[model samples]
Target: MSAEGSRAAQIKPFVRQALVCPVDKGPLLDAGDELYNPRLRVAYRIDADGIAVMLADEARKVDEAEHQRLTA
Candidate 1:
């Protein structure tokens, strides 16, 4: 591959590494089951067992403090 292409590939991880949650400025965690947004108190689960579920609104508010610490 070209030098520019290799350089771009190397930078991809760094670019993705720089992304942090807007709410808490903390790292987002992949809980295997889902991607939990602690600040928003939401857990986005995809393809769980056999169903795709989105935890939002009141359901997402179940563990606000726990999620915050997880993200932090």
Candidate 2:
């Protein structure tokens, strides 16, 4: 596996079932470099430096079209 992939795998256990969305207090899906909330249609980016930015303000609001595509 690639280095990025390995890092993501390693980080998965640390965040999975642990991290939650600050805005809605909902569960977050660990999508490699991004933590996504399908219920709220928001995505928080994981920095290349290994920092998980869980702040709502730092998250991107996914529009209806993208949300459907992502959740589907």
Candidate 3:
């Protein structure tokens, strides 16, 4: 598997339930190493260490198409 995919596999089960969007305080879905919030149109990066950087400043604001893709 790709590195990101591998990382996701390792981190998803441990962190998925605990991840939340720091901006909107909403649940996040695992999108590779990023945790995405469809409602907020943002994605938070998971570090190589398997820790999520959930800070708002660390979040990436996705466009509508990307949001749809991530959510899908």
Best by lDDT: 3
lDDT of 2 at 8: 40
lDDT of each: 0.47, 0.74, 0.76
Model 1 Cα lDDT, one tens digit per residue, 8-64 = 233345643664544565654444444456555665453524222433432344375
Report how far off residue 48 is in candidate 2 (Å): 0.3
Off by over 4 Å in 1: 1-27, 48-59, 64-72
Q: For residues 5-70, write the lDDT of model 3, one tens digit per residue.
A: 654556756566666777777888777877788887888887899787878987898998887887
lDDT of 1 at 67: 68
TM-score of each: 0.35, 0.73, 0.78
Q: Candidate 1 has what TM-score?
A: 0.35
Enumerate residue pairs that collide in model 3.
Answer: none
lDDT (C-alpha) at residue 38 in model 1: 59
Candidate 3: which stretches are off by over 4 Å? 1-6, 12-14
Candidate ranking under lDDT, highest first, comes to: 3, 2, 1
RMSD of each: 10.9, 3.1, 2.5
